[model samples]
Each structure stands twice: as C-alpha cells, then as structure tokens.
Target chain A: MPSDGITAVKQLFTRLVYSLGRETATRELKWMKQALIASHSPTLAAMLQRRLSGEPLQYILGTTPFGPLDLLTRPPTLIPRPETEDWTLRLADMLTPTPVRPLTVLDLCTGTGCIPLLLCHLWPPGSTRAYGVDISQHAIRLAADNAARCNIPSFQPAPYSQNVFIPVLGDLRDPDVFKRLLPPFDIITANPPYIPKREYDKLPVSVKNYEDPAALLGDPPDSEEQDGLTFYRLISKILRQKGMLRDGSIVALEVGRAQADAVEGILQQSAGLRNTQVWKDPWNVKRVVLARA
Target chain B: MSSPEDIARARQLKELEPLHEAWSNWTHARQSLEETLPLMQDPDPTMRTLASEEFTSLTHTLSTHISTTFPSLLVPPSSTRDLHALLELKAGVGGSEAALFLLDLLRVYVRYAGSVGWRTSIIQSSETESGGMRDAILEIKGEGAYDALRWESGVHRVQRVPATESSGRTHTSTVAVIVLPLSEDAESMSGNDELFKMEDVKVEVMRARGAGGQHVNKTESAVRLTHTPTGITVSMQDERSQHQNKRRAFQVLRARLMDVKLSQDIANRRATRRNLVRTADRSEKIRTYNYAQDRVTDHRIGLSLMNLTSFLEGDGVQDFLDALRRNWQEEVMEDVVGESE
Candidate 1:
C-alpha cells in the first residue's frame, strides 16, 4: 500500500525475476529482507539491490543449503547444486541400506562438505566414516564449519573410531594428497569443476561474476583431448597408483551435461574401474557417472 | 455404556501397567543408592574405598534410570507417531512476499529433512511469475517424519522489510504449513486397482509452462487429475512425458485421499481429549519469524529463540521442535495423570 516502497519493491523484484526466474527472485528478495534485518545495515539493502542488478544470491546470502548441511559460500568455493544433492542422497541411500562392513567414503574436491556431511548423517554412526578433501583452504574451513554446525562427528584417527565426518585440505591433482588419507574407501564421490573455459564464459552473468573461475574451470583445455577431464584423470590415477579404492567400491562423480561418457572413459582406462553407469538427474540430463573399482 | 473418556482412561492404565513395573525397578535402584551412601563414610580405609566405588556406581545407575527410562514412560505412543509426512505450504497474507516466505519455509523443512536423513520431494508446486511459490506440496518419507513435522502445521508469520521496498519499512507476511501423516498403507493402496476408480478421475492435459525450451509450447505434457467425487485436484508438469505426469498426479491424489481418511480417524481419537490440549489447526498462527531482532517465537509453546537466521536456515529450528515434542509429551502425561485422578 506504500506506493513508493511498492514501486521500489516491484522494480527490485522484476530484476531478480529476470535474472534468477520468479521463484529464485522471490527467495532472494526474502533473503535480502532477512539480511537487512539481521545486520540492520543499509549496505545489506544495497547488496540486495546489487543482486537485483544480477548478483548470485548464494554469494549475497553467504550460505546455501547443501543436502542436509548449511554450507558457507565464499568466492573460493563452488556453490553446491540440486544435482549434487540428488546424487549424494542417492549414493547415501545406496550405501546405507545393506552395509555389510564398516564403510569408508572419500569425497574428492569436496566444495562445502555437502556430500560427506550427508553421507555421515545418513549412514549409521559408528559404522561408516567419511573424509572430504578440497584444495581450497577457504572451502575446507567452510566445510569444517558445516560439519560442526550439522553435529557430524569429526574424524578421529583411532582404530574403529565412532567419529564420521572429516574435512581435509589437499589438491586432488597432487599424487601426495592420497598419502595422508586412510583409504581403500568403499565409496568416493566427486563433483569437480567440469566446465570447459568456453562453456564457462557463456554461463549466466550471476554465475560468471560471483562464482570462482577455478571452481568452474579446473584447467584450460590444452587441446581437444584435455577439456574438463583433467581432474577425473588425476583422481583416477591417484586412486589406482595408491591402491586407495577397495574392490567393489564405487567412485561417483557429478559430470556436466555431455561429459559423462568422457568421465566414464577416464575412470575405466586409468583406474581399471568396471561396470560404469551414467545417471540422469531430476532434469533428465546425464549428470553423474558411477563406476566400480 | 462407558463414555469415550472412561475408555481412554482404561487404555492409559493398561499401557502404564508395564511401565509401572519399570518404575518399580527405579525405586529399587534408588533404594540401593540410599543403602550404599552410608558405607562411603565407613571408618576402615579399605571398607570406605569399596563403599565409595559402590555408591558412585549405584548413583550413576539411578541417575540414568531417572533421566532416560523414567521420563520416556509418560507419553503413550500414538499410531501416527512414526508415519511419513506430506507438508503443503500455501502463501497467506502479504501477496508475493508471502509466496517468497513459502519458498523459505519449504527450504527450511527440506534442509531439516536432509539433516535427519529423510527423503523429500516436491510432488506439486505452482510458482508465481516472480519466482515465488504460490503453493507447494512436499512429501517427506522416512522414519518419524510425521512425528518430527506434525508441529510444523499452522501458520508461520515472517516480520521484516520487503526487499522491494524503497523506504525500508518492516512488513508482516504469513505462510500456512499443513503437515499430514502419509499412511504406510497408502503405498499399497496406490497399487490397488479399486482404491481410486479410474472412472472417477477427470484427466486433463496441457502444454507445460516455464522453461522446457521448444518442448514447453509444443507438447501437452502437463497432466491434471481431479477426483470427481471428492473434488480434490492435483497437477504435475515437471516431468517430461504426459504419462509420467499422470502417474505423479495420481500418486499425489491417492496420498491426499489417504490424508483425508487419516485426519478423520485422528479427529475421532482426538475428540476424547479436546479439553486437554488444542488440536492442530491450520488457521492458527503457530510461530513468528522476527528478522529485525533475529528472533523466532513459537506462539504455541511460548518459546522464543534469538537465532532467527539459523532457524530459517534449518539449523536452530530443531530447538523449537525439541521443545514442542517435550511440551507435548508433558501435556500427554498431565492428561494421563488427570484421567487417573
């Protein structure tokens, strides 16, 4: 009923609707209102105005729901998507129902510890252990905060420990990353940066501007051979060389729309992974590749 | 002929009989603790040490019995306690802001479900032009889903300035959350050919709206089902094929019908204890989210928490839930105690 406020609200809402669609815009506006109220800072309102001008809401809110965990979002880590949530929950359900032995899960390139936190939460506590490794210190720190906030037990190295969730900082590209890990893991999940540089550039301004490029484009594709497949190759090689994957263990990775075949190939050729399967997300797009080792 | 109240009291006493035996065990443990207490101060050093150890162990056992085993006996388990939940969120007052708040409420439940390992899915949703959900139905399936989410019914009001506001004045918006327990038998009933007669359902197909590229306008993929007798309608458009949409729509319809049947049963059971506590009412404003002060107050329980952001983010909502469950149990215990008197 306040005409000026209504007009302003409509304008801000319109911009958000344009960029994020109506649902997301509405959510972002609510978050902005909350952020404004929490900080009592006019700058927070200004940030919402910026969001209306095409800023990602996750960056503005500084947190996003990742599966069951509320993960802190900074510029350094990639935002967890709905696809990741679907696969992680699916994998958790797959593993938890008939776990014959004490299971161990290793999440590679764990952005905000979503996968591991969810895995630990779903799996029977004292029987299943999970470790999340990410190269970014900021991501690791955020993941640790999520683990503590979600009340998942932290990793304790004692034999057959009850603690289930652990976040470690290390590069997946490095062979030495496997050294500190307690492996022969029953399951490994990764949602590494799989977008090629060209595809990344074409992303919506909200993503291109706010999200880290390193979290989107792993390394510049050096030829037709190297496009977004570097992380998969590195992970498979490390697992194979270190003998880190237990027999009959699964390595599940979230892949881009058309990247599932390439990812499956990489895992099969390098890791000697067998029985590869591609899973479609809710959107019916090929999103995850699951391979047994 | 006995009144319903008399029957309920009889039932309560019958349930309490086993618990009363467990209660006697607690009395015995307390007696053991009292007997051991005097020996802790014995004159002989060896005797004193032995007595102290026995006293400590007996006290620990008594404390555990009192804390864990004793309080659990008070609340009688209801048939609906372990059922799955279907949570529907509808935008109430304050227009689009209410729709936005509905989305927030949905996220809170979804995230909370995820944290507890419950599986949740949006069975039906109608989004406003501005991206806010007009109404959404979420099915949360897992052990104790209904038990955890039943208190989440009723209206949730949010107080804060609208993001679209130029002159920054706080506004209040309400979103109604209706949580219905999904019967485990509903899954079997869905498969039963006679549960919902095909002749009773009016099926309609339409072109799906919003973001399927060329497929959105070209194909009549969305399916709507209206049960002619009950006037219950469900629409599903998210899936690609019309067949899939029809299946989903029918599934939701069956669940809704099941909910109605279950609610009637609940109403009957609840009629006996109507004076003990207010039944779940959707029109009631159960909770308030005051963002300006970073506070959330559950009006039903009279519990106020200062961490509104965390609560909305699905972190601190558990506090309110825990308190509500505890309070509900306490009320049940009081009702039982009153009936005994």
Candidate 2:
C-alpha cells in the first residue's frame, strides 16, 4: 500500500536513525514519537518532508537536547552545534565535579544562552549563578524563551516552570557593560565570532546567509587588527579589572581552528593572564583555550 | 478490521499529517491574514470583533518580526536633547603628517555636501596650533542632510604628507563629525521657523580664530551654545561676527536636537531593536583610511574602498556614500517590514 503520513514519518525517522548511530537512532525515535503525540498536528509530516529536503531536523522540531536540557535553536542564534554542546558538558565536568564553593560564571557573547543555562542546571544548587550576555536582542529573547522552554517540560505546573537563566543585553566591546552585570565568577566562557572577513565569505551557505554578519566575521570595517581577537582582548581586560574572576580564576574560550596561536599571543601579551592551555575538540582540531588569571 | 492498537496507530498516522501542515503553513497563514486585514472593515458588531482580533494578532506578529530582525536601527530618548539620535561621521586619519590629511577630509565632505546643494557652515573648530583642525563640527542644511551624513560617525585616520613638515613624513590624525536634523520631526520640507527654547541653552561669546583672518582675536565673535539638559554642547567660532556665530551655533543645536527627536520616534516604534543593539557605539572604530594601501575599509560591513586618493582628496566620494546609504536604508526597511509582519 502507498504510505500514509504516519508510515511516511516512520520511514523518514528510520532513515534518520540509520543516518545516526543505532543507540541515538533509538533514542531520537522515542522522542519523535512523543513529539508526534504532543504536536498532534499534520505538520509532523511537513516536518519530516522538510528534514528529508536537507533542512536540519532541529529546525523542523524547533528544539534540541543540550546535556539534560532542551533548547530552542533558530537562525542567527546558531543551531547549537553538537560539538559546542560537547565542549560545554566537558567544561561543566571540569568545573563542577565536586563543588567546593559557590561558583560565579560568565558566558560572554552568549547567543542563545545555551551554555550558561546548562551550566546552571549542572552545578549544585545555589553553588552557581550563570549570566548570558548577547548583543542581539532577538538572540537574547530566543535564549530567554529557550531558558523557559528547557527548564520545564511543556506540561509542567506553572509555579515550577522557570529555567532561572539570567540574560543581559549589551555589547561585549563596551567596557562599562561588565560593571552593570552581576559580580564576577569563578569561570568565564565564550565562543565569540572569530572568522576573518575573507574566511567568513567562504563559510558554508548554511552559515554565511543565515547567521548575523557580526557573528560570522571578526572585524568589519576599519580594523587593522585581526578582528576575531578583539573580543578576547576585551574579555581578558574585563576579567583582570573587574575582579569578577579570582586571581587564577579559569577562562575557557572556544576558538576558530587556526586562531590558537594569535589568541595565545594576545593572552600572553595581555596583563594579569596566566596558565593558558589549549584543548582539542573531538575532531582533534584545536578548539578550546583554557586560561587562568 | 483493525485491532484497537492498530486502529490507534492509524489514528496516530492520521494526526501526523495535520501537525506537519500546521507547522509549515504558520508563516503563510500569518501573511494571508495580514493581507486580508484592510478588506474586512465591517461595521457589524460580530464582524468588528472578529476583524479587530485578527488585525491585532497580525500587527503583533509584524512588530515582533521587526523587533527580531532590525533590533538596533533605532535609539530611545532618555533626555530632551535626544543626543543618541545624532548622525555620526568620521574623517580619515593619518598621523602628525595627517593634518593635511584631515584638511583633505574636510574639503572632501564640504565639496560632497556642496554637490548635493546643501548649505555647509563650520559651526565650531579647534585647530592644531600647527595647522588644520583638532576637531570640527559642521552643520549642513539641506533636504535629508542629517540622514545622509549620519553613517559617517567613527574615527577617521588619514595617512599622507603634511605641507608644514619639510621631511616629507606622513602622519596620521583623527577628526569626528556629528550631523543632526534641524528639527527632530522636520525633514527637508519642514520650515526652519521652529526654534529650540533658549532657557535650556547656555550661550557664551568669545573671540574667533584659525583661518578666518586678522579679525580673529579682536572681537567677541565666537558663540558657544550648550543644551544643559542633554549636555549637547555646540560652538561656532568659524564665523566672522557674533550674530553669525550665534546663528550658526543655534542652527547646529537645532539640527542636533531634531535629529535626536527623530531617532527617538524611530526607536519608540522599534524599541527592542534599539535597546538591544548598540546603534550609537560611535567610539567603535567603524572605518579606517590607510594611506599605505590607498584603501578605506569599514569594519562593520567589511566593505573597503580602494580609491582612497579620490575619496579623501574631495574627488569621487558619492560611490561610498551611496553604498552606505543603501545598506542603512535596507536595514531600516528591514526593521519596518519586520515590525509590520
């Protein structure tokens, strides 16, 4: 028999499972079934069709899992690259394995508040307060909305439905912005816009068109300096001056592939920075830079 | 005949298609509702209620889209002067030798403004004692004058040889410009009869100096008008007489106040866009003119102009302005459209 919407969805999901590994396939299908019941609309067929047409399943579903948390990812806020999520969980493990003291954390250029919210959820109660700052208001709203959606399941009672994620609006480039934010924390994390203009032009179509130009390119108009490193310089200065981080507080930055050397160079030249270390992503590309001040 | 579980499975399958339809058709349904709004202005109670609800929902979506897409194009007014609404412009910077570079920048803008039939008057200028201006504020009066010049704010560094330095060394210097509309609400067609309240302004008179000739030190011809509430200070020392200086200072102040008000209105219409985005982060180096490379690069848009000699020397500047204007207008329109969605 020719397939019905449910049969087509089933086949499409089977293909999705086959594309992913077996364990993941099983888990995702289980969720997909739940989503089908929850959505209770024929749009699930359209969602399947869109996914089959090469639209990201995340885009169709409108939410994805980040550690134990569910996040809404949309255009400009960057669909939380699984790799970034992996780095987040890794950072969480290193910082909060056995909470010794209350942890103050800052997530800079926090587009969708994904990292900070997860950090809050993973850390021990009252031991961590997370801050997410983004220059884009829509991104902040998306992040705030995601925070709400992720903390409580759709059906949860009203009183318990808060993600408790604090989202601030301001540019990272502004020195005064840090002063208005909550007091400094034990760790500062950011995955800033690092691609040089030329390199940004060559980004895959998925990124070049959908994301904001500021997020894609490091420097825009008159910057003589490599624009990607400007945020790092600003962050390093803010950390040193604000006392947000204790002396020897940790800084973990996710960097572009070839940016390790230049970033390191800036960190070394910068005052009050020390113990700079680089870590590789699962792909073995030098991805994260962990530093202490 | 199907078992109850099989029947439930088929029912689940049937439910999948509508969910898919609902999600995919959301934007389209929203758009159609927007398009049909103007046609349904019925006077009947039930029809009016139905229409009002639909119109409200459509307008909400449009405004939300606008807030999301063009978040920083407008700025709110926290003060009377609306200082945040002023247009930003930058002159190219070079070094000590860059005095000539700044002079060249001044000439380029004055000429470009002239080309558009705009009346340009230098309201206040501080010269480098050696030569050229340390900083200068020029008031251009024309149709769309402030709107045209607002994008130029940022540090301009010029690189070239100075006429005073015999060693033929190139120096870099900087000049910043602020353009404001004559009245916050008035465009080019608006009459210039409207005057700002003098009570809010502090006017001071002093001697005029710089390139204006020998009468520079003798007379109290220079005028400084400070809008106390907004802290927007304007001075006109370039004119020859006190009356002329006062008029120029007031004109500049009016333009600035108007620009601020206009921006405030735009921001009010798109508050989320302005509040979330740093529209007037003028201190951020927006563009740089490199004498070595003969290039002018904008860091915000990543656009670089190779014809530096022509651009800085008061020669072929319209192309750059046109490009910037196109980008800014596009951004503004995007915000408007987004708000309407």
Candidate 3:
C-alpha cells in the first residue's frame, strides 16, 4: 500500500530524486564540499538541514520564475508550480486577439499573480487587462509586486490598455466579489485549492508545512459542510450569473488528481457551460478542466 | 636506421601535413617546369607554346606556395589543434583608445570568422562609455579555428591618431588578444583531473533549499565557481538557466586552469621552451599596426604588410598570419637541425 496516500505521484523513486534534477542535486550537494573548503555562508550542513526538514528553497530565496517574470514568493501564498505553468501556457495558446477586440482575462485564486502576469507578459503590454482575484491580501500584494517586477515591454501596433494585471482581493464565498470584476472577459483561468479535507493531512511535509493550507484545501475553513468542490461550485454559480463571462469566453481551472471528470460535470450541469474539455499534464494525469460558456 | 622511438617522436612532433603538402606541391611543380624547359626548345611550334605556358604556370604555382603556404613544421602538434578557440581581448594602454582598438580587434575576428565560414559568438562583452569594449571573450566554433588563431595570443599594438584627441598626434595603444582552445564536449574540460581538482574548487550557488520537487518554485540560478587554492573565481549569470551557467563556467574555468597549468609546465621546462617560437609571455608586444605608414608589422618575424585598412577590416591579416606561421616553422626546423648536429 502507498504510504503518502497521494493518488497521482509514482512512489517508484524517493521524493528527493523526483524533486530535483541530477545537476541541481549535485549542485546543492556541492555546497557541502564547498563548505569544507571555504566556510561560506549557507554551508552544506545548514542547507542540508533546511532541505531535509522540508523547507522550500524558493521561500528561502524569496523569488521564483513565472514564465519570463521573476516573482517574489512567501509562505502565506502558494508558490507557482511547473504543472501550473504548463497548463497556463496551454491556456494562453487557446487565447488570441480577435481582429477587432482586445483580449481580457480574469485569474482567480491568483497566488503570486503568476497566471494573469504571465498572460500579460506573453501578450502585448496594452493588449491585455488581466485581473487576479484572491481572498488573501498577501497573495494579492505578492501578485501586484510581481506585475511591477515583470514590467513587460510592449511592441507597437498594440493599442494601449490600462493596468495589464490588477490584483483584486475578494472572497469566493461572497456574492459581492463579482461586483469588483471587469466584465466580458475573453478567458477566466483559475488554479483554486481542490484537495479535500481528508486528503490534506496526507500531503508531504514540504507542501503542508511551507505552503498555506487555505491555498491547497478545497473546503472552506471551519465550515460544517466541507465539500472538496466549494470553490468550483461557487465559480460555476458565478458563471451562471450574467456579466462575468462573454460569448466564446471560457473558465479554465487546474484540478486535483482524479477530479477532472467531477469538475467538468459540475461546470456543464450547473454553470450552463457546453463543450467542456479535460487536459492532461506531462505526468499523463488530467490536471486542468475547461468549459466554454 | 629509424627506431620506433624516433618514429613515434616524429609523429608527435608537429602538425606538418599542410606544410608538407605545400612543399611537395612546390617541388613537384619545379620538377615539371624543368621537364617543360627542354620541350620549349622542340621544333613543333604548338608544343613550344604549350610547354612555355606550362612552365610559366608551374613557376607561378611554386612562387605562391613559397610566399603564402605555411612553412614546413611551423605549428606544433597541440591538443588545441582539434579544438575550438575562445578569443579574449582586453584593452591595454592609452585608456579609451585602447578600448576602441579592442572593439575593432573583436570586429576583425568576427568578420574574419564570417569570411572563413566559422561561427563566432560574443560570450562575455562589456562595452566602455566611449563606444568601445573594455574586455570581451569571443567564442569561435569551427574546424581549425584554434589552429588558425593560436599564434594570435600576445599583445597587438595599434598606432593611430586618436579620434578623441584634440590634436592629431599618433598615440600608441595596445589590445591584448589571447586565443585559448576549447573542447567541443565541455565535459572533457571539467572532467580533467590533472589541470584542476574538483575538491579544490568551491561551487557557490543560491543554496537550493526545498523538499526537492514541484512543491518549490525553481529559481533563476546564478553560479559562481571559486578555486579556493588560487582565489580564482568565475561568476556566470548570462545564461537563462543555472545548469547552463555552471556548464559554461566550468568550460571557462577549464580553459583558465589549463592556462595556469601550462604556464607552470613551461616555466619548469625552461630548457626545452627555448626551442619553441611562441613564447608564453602575453605581455610582450608581438604585432604592431601602424596607421601612419599604412602598414601592419609582425615584430617577431620582422614582416610588414601594406594596406592596413583592408587588414583591420580582416582581409590582409591572413597574409601576416601565414608569414608568421611559416617563419615559426623555419625556426623550429633550425632548432631540430641544430639538435641533430
């Protein structure tokens, strides 16, 4: 029987081997040998202890790569993952400026504001107005900071648009959050917390200890009815209400393991979305589920 | 009368194939011209005309080979012969003028590489405020890149009236160009144990702390490899990824470590070093580019070439390279003959 109880990850190799490439593995280990010779700061033993104890390197370094941008990350907000980046790129590929209209995007639970910021960076500076909505102020602040840090250069022929990425702090549970959003979006991308309460305890210490629990857990905190699909159900309800999504626009969301079918069904039945599709990540697991309104 | 040791030593001695081919071609053409001399005296008018044409052509061929072809056994057999080259140029005397000349020297190399169909990339370049390069490393990757540019190691002095000067007084500025051989597979360089020890070097990276997977956001890694023993530090941040920076740093480190090792080896073998034409000293001025006389002169061989404009533009420089190479080979042959005596 698998010990960690995670459905997706193959436990064939140790987590450490799965985590870093051989070059980086050796590079990190090199500091140990280096410490013996030079007595440098962040010595081998200290780095090993920090890593072995399940602290994130990015959190320690305070910066992470999001597409072309370098984003500042903290423990309060979820760090951007490679899987998220993969699906985001796939999502970005689906969107293009109509001959007449500019592309507008709204990214929910935008930890590090990586999604909207990446879309902004990929798009012409004035071609996009991406809004990143997260309940946590820390997430919104970090996302806003990343927007300034990236400062993507715009090429000519792209008409100027105001504020490419706007970090909005709004709770998903509240009905009033939709009032803050700019309507008629071309794309609505979300990487919401989808892990059920029962599955949360089984997560690796690296994730459970370092990252925010609210960002990973699908259930609302301290609520009696703790369904894993709280955010997804709310997003569908929000979609059903007119003014958020325009014609031909989509709501593409990153999902947890084995939840793509469940999320797709919810979007189709409740949100009045048709042609819902499930996209697989590199690991061959369906990681993102999308539906067109 | 030749033993196995003698044969092996001869094989290891020099890269003389091109020189040997030139000599053989020159001698064969001379022999053919001698044969045609008698044919020119024949009674048949057509035969005489054909023979005279053949003699003239053969004489021209022999003269071209003598004047332009690399002299016999000039280039020493080197591990560098099969490798690529990293041309490092640093501005030496006369401040900004030296820096500008360095830029000109870099352009000349890039242009030369372009003409020869060799690929050149400016690996590390820092430009001066006066529209010049302070120091730069141009990577030339092609067959015979190192061999063609190996003799271009020492100081190249440029005599020109400064564009920045108020009065037109010729100022002597220098640009030091060092050509170092680089292996195609960078692993061979970093893997070598004799030149540098893995233990002596300390690789300083942003200590990648994390649970070791997708859970941590990967950084834009910057690597700095320090030789703890020599205090030689190579910091690389130009590459997008950390792994590439480390690999690039290791390659440069390998080249520099080899430089240090070879310098020590040459110093230890002072007796044997006297016979070689190329000195290890990079500080000494080897070539002088005189704008006043429109001449480019190689100080070592006492050879002067006219049309300095075309030379700086990378056309006429080949003539000097060929001449110096031939002269170097002649000197080695003399030393070898003297040893046999």
Top candidate, metric DockQ: 3
Error of 2 at A57 (Å): 2.5
Off by over 4 Å in 1: A1-10, A18-23, A34-44, A97-100, A158-161, A221-226, B1-255, B259-341
Candidate 3 lDDT for residue A29 = 44
Docking quality level of the chain pair in candidate 3: incorrect
lDDT for every model? 0.74, 0.62, 0.73
lDDT of 1 at B311: 87
Candidate with top lDDT is 1
lDDT tens digits, residue span A47-113, model 3: 5546656677666555656555667888768988756766776776677654246787888898898
The local lDDT score (0 to 100) that residue A268 gets in candidate 1 is 81
Cα lDDT of candidate 2 equals 0.62
lDDT of 1 at A193: 77
Full candidate order by lDDT, most accurate first: 1, 3, 2
Higher DockQ: candidate 1 or 2? 1
Q: Rank the candidates by DockQ, best first.
A: 3, 1, 2
Residue B288 of model 1: what lDDT?
94
Q: Which has the better TM-score: candidate 1, or candidate 2? A: 1
**lDDT (10s digit) by residue, model 3, range B255-316:** 77766776666566547646554464788789999999999888887888888988887588
